[model samples]
Target: MKKIPVLFILVLLLAFWGCSQKEKKVSVKKVGPIDPQMVQDQDDMTWEDYKPIPEISWADPSIKPKRGFKMALVAVDFPDQPFVITQPKGSDLFGNPQIDPIKREDVAQFYRDFFIKPSDVNHGQTINGYWMEQSRGEFGITEVDAYGPYQLPKNLWEYGLNEWGQNDFTPDGSKPKGRMERDVDSLWRAEYGDLRKNYDAILRIYASYDETGVWQEFGEMKFNSKEDIPPEWGNPNPDKPRWVATRYVPWTSWKAGAMQWGISSIRQGENSGTITHELGHYAFRIGDNNNNPYVEPYRRAGSGPWDMMDRGCFNGPGGPHKRWVVPAIAGASMPAGLMVRNRMKNDFLTEDDILRLSRDSLAVTGLAVANITARAVEPFEGEYAGVIVELDGEEPHDRTPVDDPAENPLSPGIPNYDYYSLEVVQRIGYDSYCPDNGVLLAKNRDKESRNGGVNQFNCFNWVIDAHPEDINMVDYDKPNGEKVMRTIADYRQLNDALFHAGLNSGSEFEYDDPYNRLHFYIIDLHRNQEGILSYTIGVKSLDGSGAAKRDFQLTAPKTTKESVALFTLKNKDKKAGLDASCFDNDIYRLAVSTEGEGLKAEILNELAVVSSGEEISIPVYFSEEDGEKSDVRITLTAVSESDPSKKMEASYVIP
Candidate 1:
């Protein structure tokens, strides 16, 4: 072999060493715990701040609907119970008057405007407006014909006292009178023979409150114990206890337990009802996404307060307890907008509205990044309303372990999820009543079904809670002053489930699922001039380094404030390497450590994203507990989410 120069051999060795170092992977360092105090709450939001949707009325001559539904609104009252509208009673049942009583014709017009016309009573919100907004003006109730403040043959208690062990407590000590549906439909049919065939659906506005709205407010929530329930609120038979067995909880006041729950069947509702939720079922066939909240062996909520099909139906001015208010101005009034999954199920979203990918394809595609607009508004052109990653490939594509919810209620149930979904929620439109606004991440199934086993509840959409630990919120105080904590399964437990970006934002910026071989990152948040929210998000497979060559450079720390150090991280790749077509942006997870006595350090922004040749600045705040001067050494590390091997670290020393 020809002799090679030693200098040339040295150059080859140096190049090989540099290349090896570039491909070397670095283990991720543990970051400090997120500050619980940093989490944001929706308490500041009020009805005044709500972003209004353009009002659409059924009576408008210029308005027309494409997939319009013509609904018939029939009001019926029992012989024993008169319409609350005509009576205008107090806060308590049949007590002193609160608002002035209206005539029967006025009641009919009230509902007419409530359902289809934008009016002051409905907060400029109507069923037609809700549907039109949700469907992007594609579907709505274009016409609603009002009929009948008619009277039914049976007594109010007869039809109302039919559920939750209330039949035995009837005033006559006889079986409950009859079905509200049969009696109400019979009355409507008697007047206009089989007239229901003319409309898409009939909305039966009955005489009292929706049982769901009053059950807790009047039951255990009202009285400390069953014995404390007043006789007036009890069943007619004095021998029977004032409380009766009810759904979820063990007992409730007889009156509340007896009242019928609002149902999709002929869409029967009451003065304080979740009519929109019923309309969801009546029109779209969307099943309830709720679980038994007050029961034992608690299970986590499915979609929680983020979806209309869930407890989000009870969203309005005040929290759930205020649902008993008449004319439905409080809870169960303006329900949350439909989530991406339900919207797709209802065909409300077009193909362009969702960016779809396959879990198997992600391995080849590297990391996928997109900006997702809030579900309540239209996405900007070329952006998506949501992202869906289909769990495709192996027989059991979802590798999540099935743990016992009885042991850990926070456990992800069943491990049979079909896909993952990501979308943003903003306090705009109907979502104005939602608890907070942030990126919503969840595991979902193609079809709605129960998880079976101990957590035998609906398992269609399982939201990944950012804070899985108990929120430790008190649901209510007993009459005796004992506090009743909200259960782990309570839908409100997910009130803080959203994932937010940036440091001190009162939410997590990223989630890692080693079992599912996926990592999700909420890189940043954006709000348009119109007050619509969107998030720049990234999803990468753990099994592969992304298709693009990932590299970044961190600048030396600069002191901006007395105890704050700022650093700029720039994506060093001048060009999209290897796969330019697939390259989006580089996301980095940052951590900081301090070496000093009584000193603590926190990264204001723990996660960052930079497009090719772009940069972002991160700030680290340091504090001393003892108020004593000491030399401090701060080490900041950045790890590329696309390729963990590309890691960089910088240190700043303060004397």
Candidate 2:
């Protein structure tokens, strides 16, 4: 080879050395500390400043279909194969289950007569309710289940679907139903004292509750299944188990009744009364008809703690179908037909239902209504690096809301905060909001920082370092500064549950709620991605029934002042802080409605204001109406200059 020129040779050597020194980039998911590119203050800041210009926008989606009514069919195909339907040898106090084994024909007709057919105007009786005729569900039921012998599955008891033994419980580990199928008729026999009583009460008060002129909401609540779920462990055919119960098709989607019609081991028990529970799903799609311990919201679950819809209510006397006060049972009342119907269909408050449940959506801040309100919040982005939760915080204890804004200081946005009987230093503590606020609350105790950039409070998650007893106390071994982190093992079980439902991702995942966390009724922490990640605290299905701690976050609330013709929000100081409106502070609880794809998304960010990294829950809300268009993504930028055009920016949206 020809000898290289001295200058060229030196250049080649230098180039080779530079290439050798370069290293390959390894990917890491950990979002690093604020990128310098995120910094806009190239020069130190003066106290006074104006915001940088932003692309102005705001829009809202109108005609977003109001909750509409829909239905799905779930007929109980009680054993398509032949089975000997029997009954218990005796009767109960109700005289309901003394006989058995009529023909499948009689069993099928009974349900159709009770739930599917028109009540013939009850002739002479004053029949009322939605006679104005709101569309009742289109009724249909599968043919009677194919008759078959009581073929017990080898592991029926182990699975607990069959209530043969006392140990047989719910799918999520609750006590098993104790109703024995007695007086075996051609179909089956078993007394449903409380369950039937509830059905009669519903029939007794149908018109008074819904004088809308519409017929029975569900003219037909059908059931379809093998009419039996063999216990995985103990006895083969355990009484008459309701196979198809109330359930929602998608999240709040077309809800319908389900049941296992005829085909049972007990006598006189096989009738449509059992099917009434499932028919509730169709009639109201708001809750189940029967307080089936096997269902999700069995007979005692509510954000208010317990109700007649939570699982394991058989333990409570008067549960398992038994009405409490002989008049109505449970508390001072029973659930009204309007309760589930209005709440689910129109997001309306059902006075009668609230009255029956001994609760009032119009009197107190009913949790169901509150949940509906809280769900209105929009998210910051598609997914998030982590979640922020606030379970309990500094609010006066014994807070009694009186529906009217005049009685309660917090409602109607007067003070926008409620009065509490707590210490002065303990008002609006961290547990009352999403945990993201806690990250900032850690510094609230600092006497030097009362108004360190954060002036007013929005949610409980904004305050941190509050072992104030006023805030929820959680067990934590160690913390990684932003969020607590110790054993990834402890969280694995939750991770697995979410994963199985296609809710979350990452094999070595980690998350913690040190404070049990606030649930803003966004119900699920779900995403529509491949891993189908979400957060679940055992509310096994999409139908509403359970508490979830994952749907919380501090939002950047709204304000009257907005940047004119610019895509930016103003700061309370009357001065501009992220000139480009980088720190818009507007945020919300993300929830996906059934009418739309699970377009709901969420993202949380902790900004280190100026130099101090204090936590704060800023308020922010957005709608297509809030911006010029729905496609406009809200961006947050930080800059020292009055103009943001010359600064770096980062953004998150409710995509």
Candidate 3:
């Protein structure tokens, strides 16, 4: 072989090394705001198609008020359990009686204003305010009058120590005293004869703790076990154990476990009670959306902390565990706002406020896309407060598999659901204490009673959990040093159920139910200048593609950072070609792969929503934890959400 110059060989090696070391310049295009007008209008679709899901009517129409109404507030005190307001500061286990003793009239006025008027004590939150805001001023308490702090005939324990096992521990070992309503009502009638008929609703505020608030706090939470409960916390009968059987859990402190949890039938409440939740029962005739959260045969919560009817009533500064605090300033203080289902059930939402679609019609129309404003506020003109996709065509609309909750608490339960409701929940207004903000999607039954069967759990609204895996949160530490994990039935389990748009957003953007033949997508999120959240959502039948074409073009990838590459995916559908009457946006599912040893790649967002002529920038990150860094190739794949067959791929080499 002819001899080659050593210098020439050296130069060749140097040039090759330089070429391998060269950096690729990446240009990131700024994605603009999605135009609200781009979303298709379903004007051609009428409400008649929504016949499958009929309008919700109150069980008792007489109580459904559409205008301002009068409310009466009556205060009562027990000989044994004086009003917490009359006790010294820090008198109870929860450091209750946060204030010094006050006159009975002052206490009555405090509660009256707390329920009817906005005051600094209630943080400007009131039952009337909640109703007015929830009803959009369609209804509220026009007038509120406070009555006497009439003393009850029986001792507080007579009424409080009745439920659970307290009956066996009564002073004489007889059934705990009953007829709290009859006693209080008689007292009120004698003092203000027939005045009860003047008010639209009557609220009886009693002194002492609401069992729901103190049950766990003074029971299992304070003691290691039933056997460990001390005499001080026991019933009046010293021979009887202090612990007693209670709902959901096996045992709790007798003092609290058996106390009557604020009742709504008689509109009775306590100092540390969720009056809003009770009002939901008394005023709207809505049943509890909560599920059994403490015992075996674990079942998931219904709406969880996202709806006031559920454990969302326990929303506040300290979560459910801190509900024992008095002055009602901690947990259960600020309840979550009503969800779309409850709002509709209570006649709060208008006909035009919701975009209704029939599941059967979706198969013919392809897909429906619209923007929904947050449930906390009124929607803008041409916008909807929510989207309802009714399961229309078949005899069995919900095709979800019947799974045993006892085996897996996360099971979807009996599948006799009637429709799906999609709404946005933002941490604003009454929802300020809600855990998160995103798309709230749920499978709902038209009739609340239909939620019972295999699981025997009653739930009318079943929220779809985006992250179903156990969150592994510790509820509280037992006195014996054991860690009690929050059960699958715990309402907080749904804390991460809301779906958010884009990849790596810690939530899924879309939910696909092949059995139900539906695909729901949270395409993009937007916040107006007022800090209100809204989402551009799309729904399509898995059986067919919508009227809009699903096509996109992915640009060549470029690296802005050593291990980061950016790609712009643009919708190929021509805006001019779209039918003005019914157009649909396109959703793209992205995937990233790496071709090199010890190299790993990830895409910032696994999904993107691109409208006609619109584009989105996707970021891919590369990492090499081991082995020497070398040239690596990254492939980016984009698949159309509406039409999986339509796909595109691009690649970039990082040195």
TM-score per candidate: 0.86, 0.21, 0.83
Estimate, for each residue in 1-655, the C-alpha lDDT of model 2 and write its tens digit.
1222222232244344435544411111122111111111101111122111112100111111233222211112232111112223232211222244334334333332323222431111100111001112112221122212222222222222332222323333444332213211212212223232222112211000110010111211111122322232112234433232222211100110111111111111222222222333334333321111122221211111011111111111122223111111121111111212222243333232121211111112112211010111111132221221111233421122324322321121111221111000100111111111101110011011111111111111111111211112221222222322211111111111111111122111112222222112112123222212222111011122222111111223232111101123222222213322212221212221111222222222121111112233221222222223232344444332112232334333332
Clashing pairs in 1: 38-506, 39-506
Off by over 4 Å in 1: 1-49, 53-63, 89-98, 555-568, 572-582, 591-603, 615-636, 649-655
Which 10 residues in a row give candidate 2 its minimum summed lDDT? Answer: 420-429
lDDT (tens digit, per residue) of candidate 1 on 1-655: 1223222233344344445544322111223333232332333334665666433333242466689899888898777677776775574473422356668766766777776776676677777877777887778888888888888888777777777666766777788745788778888788889988899998888877778877887888779889898998887778878887777678888878777777887544455547888888889888888888777788778887888898888777766776776777666667887887889998989877898877877787677788888787778765689999888888898888878878877766778898999998887788878877788999988888888667577768888999788888888887778998889888888888899876666678889988888888887666565556677788888777545677899886654334456677989764545443335677788999888765676775667777887886666656555566577788889998777788999888766
Whole-model lDDT, model 1: 0.74
What is the C-alpha lDDT profile of model 3 across 1-655, one tens digit per residue?
1223222233344344435555632212222222111111111212121111012211112234468678778889887777777777887645777666777768778787766665556555666666766777667767778887889888877776676655665666667656587787788899779887788777777887777777787888889878887777887688777777776577888777656778785444455558878778887888887777876778788998888898888877677877776677667776778888889998999778988888887776666788888787788666799999998886788888777666877775778888899998876666767777788999888877635544456678889888888767888888888998888788888888898876556678789999889989877776665456677788888887656556789986544444455678998863434453334567777888877665677754465776677786666655554676666778899998777899999988766
Q: Candidate 2: lDDT of 283?
A: 40
Stronger candidate by TM-score (1 vs 2): 1
Clash pairs, candidate 3, are 366-546, 367-546, 503-606
TM-score, cand. 1 vs. native: 0.86
Model 2, position 453, has a per-residue lDDT of 15
Model with the higher lDDT, candidate 2 or 3:
3
